[model samples]
Target: MTHRIAAFGAALLATTALTVTSLSAETLRWARAAEALTQDPHAQNEGPTTTLNHQIYEPLILRNMAGEMEPALATSWEPSADNPNVWVFQIREGVTFHGGETFDASDVVFSLNRAMSENSNFRELLSGVTEVRATGDYVVEIETEGPNPLLPNNLTNIFMMDEGWSVENGAEEVQDYAGGEDTFSARNSNGTGPYVLTSREADVETVLTLNENYWGIGEFPLDVTEIIFTPIQNPATRLAAFLTGEVDFIQDVPVQDLAQVEAADGIGLGTGPQNRNIFFGLNVGADNLERDNVDGANPFADVRVREAMMIAINREAIQQVVMRGQSDPTGAMLPPPVNGWTEELEQYPEFDLDRARALMEEAGYGDGFSIQLDCPNDRYVNDEAICQAAVGMFAQIGITVNLSALPRAQHFPLIANGETDFYMLGWGVPTYDSEYVFNFLYHTRNDGRGSWNGTNFSNAEMDEMIVSLSSETDLEARNATIAELWEMAEAEMIYLPIHHQVLNWGVSDAWSTLVDADDQVKFKYFELN
Candidate 1:
């Protein structure tokens, strides 16, 4: 690791020297609060990871800055006329990977199959897929369990990998991100996207150069020829880098410093509401939480206790204080942009301290119990501060919250492993549908479904409805099922919905880009001033 870091630094210096002498306008220096977890596309389904991978890997379909579907690797796709259960894609021709491997239907089939593997973090996204096959050189077909109207929507983030290159590097299997396993794919990449990875130092810096032979060279802006990504965890340091012209872009601008950034001379701020909801999850299904003060049973298991905890949180206060009036207090797990979100579903209980206290007593926990809340300090805007506020709110009702604030890398695994009693998580529906949430958070944890459901709240009836949403061709029937699932989750208090995050991106005036509702910055759409 030491040698690799040293080599990466040397390579970056050389690239910087070359850019200083020539092609400076073609270079884009990007920084963020946290770096991508890994380079293996299927290893982690995280925002940073997916944002970084978008430059190197090409998904068959991609959501643009406006959150609308656009064709990329695949020119067009539609359900097969002979079989409604089968979706066919016409893969783009004349595309080549960074390593010179031609892009074709074989790579698509291999990549999707690899994503469905047990260890892949993206397995949940392909839950309804039964089989994938290459029908021709540039044609691929996916057969789901039933007639899935939204099958194409789910493929928006499924990136294509070079089958030959993966096999040659012995990385045919996906990286086991949760298991702490590493492979060559985690540190290397070869794809047909517009950018190629030149050098990478995990959690430090990654360098990319434009693919000279990119198929979309003339079609897209493709102005930025080089990219230097630096992950600076400190907000001050990151903002300073952008203000001082050390970096060209900063994805995550501190919410409190938004005004300062806007007032800065050479820097500009792009602000929008992200399609994500921040929430807290409790181990309600556990017989006895391993990290709670209560002995015989889990207090969170009681519905009244869960409701009491929910009502105790002051969402409006958190939005005004911790978020600096930049967030929208949410009552539902799905954000407004997500389908199946209704005004009634977004109605949360009124903040009633006396009622919460009384409910706690009624649940036979008048004395209140203690529990730990695992939160990620760097993943979301004011994530740690939100947890801190919740600590005090729960304390008002005699509940002692031992706040465990850690970086996202450490905080997320605890929930994935079911080690944390209560935890905080933020969800963004990449597919823009409720099924995306149900597959990962509501379904039973088994066979690649519910991979992130740490609460262990599993119901066979609910699971069946969730699975049926994928193949339910009737629009009316599918929407009704979605509404039913949301009602069930809300009534059970599966999670405490906090608020929807507001995005602020700080960028140099030298270039301009769109602000995606999903908070993903795709440089391909950027243009140099």
Candidate 2:
């Protein structure tokens, strides 16, 4: 199945190259299962939100379709020869914001500082930065705590914002996403990207028009002049929109209907591996869960109970049945391509219901307990169904799981605010490194890091290892620390590993676009025939 998709992709690439010369301007109607939670660039770091924001905002560094780092707003960057802790960046010249403000180093300084604020969800990505200074009109310098080589990789998604525009609109500070506070920046945007936001009706539709004065006008394939994006939560309605030509592109193609879409005329299918891992999180540090049957203590705090829950989940069965062979069962939190990944870390004990039962009995949970499982129905592929399957498996062990499925907008805040006892989440490492995972998921929750660590698990030794990876210049030493941290994470069962999702994009035959491993659809790369 993978080979067939690769061949089809190659053929599509060939067709795209042959048709580029004759491409024309057209309106691209795109649909997805969920809408971007907010338009504030620094509020949310989720995939769907970032995908929508990338069209209007420009980051200092950009990850191309092939997952390679490339220059975006910043033309060139390198460590300062005089000081190893300071990195110098040369901002692009003559770039104007959508509202006609000139791009400069001050905007860069303001944007980076804004993202490092307490309300910014992207603060974890910039935890190592000590300061950001504008040396000149177009020259900026970033000083880290120590010698950091992966700073540029971390900034791939930290979008730049115009300082003047934000101040004028009374949105100088980042939106408090977890607090549910709405700001002007959440609905209005003025960026220097290839597209300008013309109309934005949250959760309904968004309209964008090409930036005629974009810096990369001729460098990219910017053939689509207008974009009309709609969020259709119902899978049937989304598929119907695609089938009837109401929508030209669908980022998420239903796995069950892949065959039907492939066999249908004037529809093209592109499949690839996504750089994300879906997992289950438990509040292991809490003395007593806020929403569970346990009386005085949290059952998840017991390693035996965690182990029992881990084995109760049959990942192979979920892969084959629920995912329809569209997922790769994984044992590690990070995917194989990420740094610090090894075959030894990928091995998991085979599923055994009998062993799980014995462990539960040994942990004084033979009678089992009931707990609420929070899941997002529209976030990941078959997420609610996966949770439903786990509920049944857990029932065999005398555990009753009350499933609570909600939209991504409502479901994420529950985890972000540490309100849910158990929840489902999917993580993607944009930096392609284990340090990115450790910094956000394993580090202790604090002002500088662990914004997403809802599990409430913390270790002083593990925190030391995680912090050392940022400043350690030696490659072997850094990797060793990463391995040690993973060893602790696996032994403690910080998160129950599920599987890596597969990317399936459904597009009309009238257009061609690359399938990114991150599942980000950049319409700037789209070519219309």
Candidate 3:
């Protein structure tokens, strides 16, 4: 009764032959159970969108699932001895873009500068980045405000663009691809990674081919001439497609389908620890709100009220029932394995309705208060169900939660704009560090730039600690700073961290080099054996 596929190739041939026969040469077809709003890497937050861009665009530095930094576009980097605020990087050589443009200092400079520019959603992502300069054709130097230690981690998301292609196409604007058609970088790729983008059908499917020009790694040892990605919205439909051999891999296997996937033969289920932490963020800055008949007031402005809501919700029940034993309930905002920064903090606390009631009564909410909650139906495992469970739990303690579950495309902008009083979100650590989660989600102010502090969770002490951790090069001192940040977040309940769900990447057994790193599945690293 094992769910392992036997003679998987023959099975795939039987199911995919119908449509794959018509697929162009060197094409690999994959599937997503949802849709993406744009092809731009900097603008989107969902997992599926990130996987697509990772194939075509190479970030300056790459990160592993354990949050360690590795070489990618940048070969090596070190801080300037004389200038604690400045860091220097040696760009990898002999690399060319898909359009035959060389990778060098100029591209690094342009990309970093663009990321920090105004109106670009990545601006906060480049915080404290004062200047980017090319000391040599293959060497780039970055100056920051302080002794920033997380620069390498931050470098993992500043994707390098072809200077020549961008300049010629007149797309130097910071947000040129925010919501536009596929550009040269989208449909084609000239990265130093293992794959190249060959074709893209917007939200439907995208095809990629192994990069023959990849300089770091020798030609990938598989014969996957092409990789095609497809987005299907229904869980049953996606599972049906996989069971029928119509697709080789599927992302985010639904909770209900886990047993079926494991029990079926000729199929395999891949699971690992993901960096994402699902939580609810409150708009503490919102001016218009009803809190215990107090007109135009925000209860979330008080730490006590925020903490009360955390105690009222039952994280354990969600983990056991709704999550179906697929999650880890947490007290800290950042998950474990994010370096030594995850401290031993107080638990999120058992769900004590009476204690919650007492706290609310003290905060002038004995009768509870009404607030709007924004949620995305297709973003996380049991996202809507989790929110609904929270709504029911809160109702038991007198909190009225109005739930609205919409698609991610529409939900992202609204939450980023602070249009929702509260919302459900799962953040994957792009840098694999606690600083990435703490600074981006809790410390930084939500200005709709690049930072994810959409809930306006701000504290001067936390902000100072984040800045210090960013510039501190000493590992011990940096860890100490990270601990301070986490402690503050726990004390303040900045974000109610649910369990770090196990990432399930169900794919064909023939796909090699398919390890789960950074909780992302890049088709470039995978090949049909």
TM-score against truth, every candidate: 0.95, 0.96, 0.87
- Residue by residue across 308-386, what tens digits does model 3's lDDT show? 8888778889988898867767775655546643335525688788888888889887877887788998878788899
Whichever of 1 and 3 has more TM-score, that candidate is 1
Q: What is the C-alpha lDDT profile of model 2 across 200-246, one tens digit per residue? A: 89889899999999999889998888889999988889999988888
Would you give me the overall lDDT of model 1?
A: 0.86
lDDT of residue 276 for candidate 2: 84
Query: What do the candidate models score in CA lDDT, each in turn?
Result: 0.86, 0.87, 0.68
Between candidates 1 and 2, which one is better according to TM-score? 2
**For model 2, the run of ten residues with the poorest summed lDDT:** 14-23
| lDDT score of residue 313 within candidate 2 | 90
- Mark the 10 consecutive residues where model 3 has the least summed lDDT: 11-20
Model 1, range 1-529, lDDT digits (tens) per residue? 0001111111111110001111267898999988898899999899999999999998999887767788999999999999989999999999999999899999999999999998888888888899999999999999999998998888887889999999999999999878788899998999888999999888888999999989998898988899999999898998888778888888888878887876777666776667789999988898998888888898999999999999999999998899988788878898776778888877888899999999999999999999988999989988999999999999999899999999988887887788888999999988878999999999999997999898999999999999999999899989999999998999999799998787777767667666677877778888777
Cα TM-score of candidate 2: 0.96
Which stretches of candidate 1 lie above 4 Å from their native place? 1-24
